[model samples]
Structure formats: structure tokens, C-alpha cells
Target: MQPTMEFLTSEEAIQVDAALLSSKEKFSTRLAIYALRCLKQIAAEKEISVEAVTAQQVSDWIKKDENIQQQLELDSNFELFFTRLVLSSLKPLKQIAQSEQQPIENLTLKQVVSWFEQESKIRQE
Candidate 1:
């Protein structure tokens, strides 16, 4: 079964050491990555990173993209799949966190996106 959104802000998971909420955070990060990539392409075309790529750019992009947001937030089985993938990778993630002396939530956007990119590459291979 698909994951329900209730646990995102539910009071229950607060009692456990659960961390699947990060799956939701990753979705936001993916959207930001999409926005950043689009901005970078525009910057490349202009031969300058002169123009400011504001939060408005990303927010507007997402605001107009109801379908994609809907799909990522509510549709398909991706959340379940992503959560399982994360659960399976917990040991390595913890190791990275411990070695770095930080929590998983402190991982930068680039780091998290790199992990996602690695997963994509593995699937393609």
C-alpha cells in the first residue's frame, strides 16, 4: 500500500526513532534541484550568472506545476519505494553521518542530490 501523509506531521512517529519523513523532504529537494538546473541552463545560455535566480523562480515554477507536485506528493508508489531504499541504506547513511559528526538531516542539498543521482545511475546500469 501507498504511504499516507498523516505520518508527516503525526504525533505518533515522534515517539519512535523513525526517519521516513526524510522521504518527503527529498521530494522538496528534488524540486529545488529541478529549479536550480533550469536556472543554471539559463545562466549558461546568457554566458553569465549575472541574473539573480530567486526563490520566486523556484516557487513560481513549482506553483505552476501542479501535476508534478501532485505526482510527487500524492501519486504513484515512489514514496514507498524511496522509503524502502532509504531503510536499506540506513547503515551507510549513519556511517556517513557519524564520520562527519552530523545528523542525516544536516546533509546538504548537493550531498542528498548526489545520492539520488547515484541511485539513478545504478538503476540505469
Candidate 2:
């Protein structure tokens, strides 16, 4: 289920659109941004760092989230798809944040795109 997620605020969307990334990269950037926010919230609630948030914790949080629960009621498949998407997107952002020694939310679009490019080249090797 590719439900449209309004993860970014209007200002954030404008900033992302102004970046020089391609359409696909922009999508990834948005996912990373959203994942970062989720991570931040989870971390705060758990009293841990964003980098320390576990996949299990994220899944539990998503399941318990009121909005997500409402969506799940409307569509059974949303939880699986959205949970996977958020988890997969979080992978690169987590890596980038660790490599850069910054919080995930502090990562820039350029940093994320660069990480993806590196991963792509590595996969081709």
C-alpha cells in the first residue's frame, strides 16, 4: 500500500524540492526525513539516543501510534507495508548519521544521497 504520507511540513517540502536531487532521490530523502522524526520521538520516549532505537521498538511504536492504528483499522495491510518502508528507509539514515557522528535528524539530503550512491556502487562491485 503506497499511501501518500505527508511526512514533511510545507517548509520541509519546499526545501527538499529546492535541492538538486532527482525525483527518486527526493522520495528517499523524504522517507529518511520521516524516519528521522520517528526515531527522534521513539528515542525521547524510551530515554535513549536515536541511534540506539531498535527495530522492535520502532515497530511497537508504530503499532501503538493512534494515527497508524486508525489507518490499520481502515486497512489491514497498512501496518506491514508502512512498517517495512519506515524500517528500510531508516537503515541508510542510521548509517549516515553514525558515519557523520550526528543525530539522524541533522543529516542533510546531500549526505543521504551520497550514502545511497556509495551503497549502489558497492552493490555493483
Candidate 3:
């Protein structure tokens, strides 16, 4: 059976902590690692983290508009995958920010991008 969101969230949190601890040597790479870790949490909940989604899956979700396709092409699949993951997680993060009277924009996008890029590199290595 698939794991619940609670389980996945906890796992992702652990992954993030590990990435942060090991990131002392490489700041950007560490951020990308943590971001990808967060994305994995969303992907796990969405049932897509187990395997890379096929082109057909992408086709089904994305618009047919040439402009949209062009924009999406700017990022590699690895990047886009984590982008989706982070975007998905943003909803709850936004809620928390609002509840705490903080700005959602204050959230660390650079760190997420960095963690995503780093994790992708590690996987490729």
C-alpha cells in the first residue's frame, strides 16, 4: 500500500535534515537537494515519485499551447519534476505563512532551486 501524506512528509523532513547537515561544503547544491527532497514528498503523495512520469503523462497535464510548451522546455525534466513538487507543497506553506502573518514570498525559492539542481546532479552521478 502507498504511504500516507503524514508518513511521506516525515520522510521528506528527514531527507531535508540530512541534506542540510551535509550541505556545509556546497551551499547551492545543498539547497537543491533539500528542494528535491521536498518535491519527492509531494510526488510520493501524488503517486508519481516511484517512477519518472512518461511523456504521455506530461502531455496529458500540460497545455497544448506552443507558448506554454516553450516555457516548460526551459527546464530539464529533473528540474520541472521538482518544480511541480515545490509548487504542490506551497499551498500548505502559504497557509502557514498567512496564519503566522508572514509573507509567503519570504519562503526560500533559491534554496529550493539549489536543492533541486544538486539532487539532480547527484542522481546523474
Candidate 4:
């Protein structure tokens, strides 16, 4: 699987404040940011591109994280559910990275939040 990734950077947290997302969108953006970090780490360690990282790799990485390990001890279901949540986020993160022609780790919070906002509008249409 992937590796441990920070949920938010100080700069990202600040940008999130400027985005004016709904609660659910905010949650998704945060998760996507975390996923990008995981993907970057996995790609670097595996000597591959970020888009080449597999879901299984990410799942394994999550399982190894100390925080996730603690949660796993308390509930097997949390591991499965959280793993899925993180895996689900990879698609959009990759898309944004691809569209921006940049490495996943280089994507800024403004870019991510703006992409989600555009997507929300598209879905509404």
C-alpha cells in the first residue's frame, strides 16, 4: 500500500479557509490532498510515476501507518472503510495532477479546491 501522509499543511489549511467550500466538499478536498501525498510517496519509493501507483500499494501503505495501526487494533471495519475512502480519493487527485501537468506533490490547495468547485458545478449542470 501507500505510506503515511499529512492531512494538511499550514499553507493548505490557510488556502482551505479562502475556498468557501461546503462541509462535504471541504472534507473531500482534505482527503484528496492527503491522497496526493500518499501517491507521491508510493511512486517515489516504487521508482514509478504517481499515476502508476496501484490501489493495493496505497492500501498497504495505509495499513503500515502507526495511526491507522492503532485504529485497526480497535476496529477491523475502520481499516477497510478508511482504506476505501483514501483509495476513492486517488482518482480526482490524479486527474488534477494530470490536468495541471505537474507532479502530485506540487499541487497547491487552491488548485485542488478550484478543481472541486468546477466539478461541483459540472455535476449540477
The list of candidate 3 runs beyond 4 A from truth reads: 1-76, 106-125
The best-first sequence of candidates by lDDT reads 4, 2, 3, 1
lDDT of 1 at 1: 68
Whole-structure CA lDDT of model 4:
0.78
Pairs of colliding residues, candidate 2:
none
Task: Give the alpha carbon lDDT tens digit for every residue of 1-125 in model 4.
Answer: 55553568878767765776777887898888777777778888999987677778877888877657766777778767877787788788878878899877688777898998888787767
Give the deviation of candidate 2 from the true structure as CA RMSD.
Answer: 4.3
Model 4 off-target regions past 4 Å?
Answer: 1-6, 102-106, 121-125
Among all windows of 10 consecutive residues in model 1, the one with the lowest summed lDDT is: 7-16
**Model 1: lDDT to the true structure:** 0.43
Between candidates 3 and 4, the one scoring higher on lDDT is 4
Predicted candidate 2 versus true structure: per-residue lDDT over 1-125, tens digit per residue: 55564668786677777766667877887778777778888988998877788778887878876657667788887877877887887678878988989888677756765676566567657
- Supply every candidate's count of residue pairs whose N, Cα or C atoms clash at under 3 angstroms: 0, 0, 6, 7
TM-score of candidate 2 to 2 decimals: 0.69
Best TM-score among the predictions, by candidate number = 4
Ranking by TM-score: 4, 2, 1, 3
Which residue pairs clash within candidate 4?
1-57, 1-58, 1-60, 1-61, 2-57, 2-58, 2-61
In order, the Cα lDDT scores of the candidates are: 0.43, 0.75, 0.44, 0.78
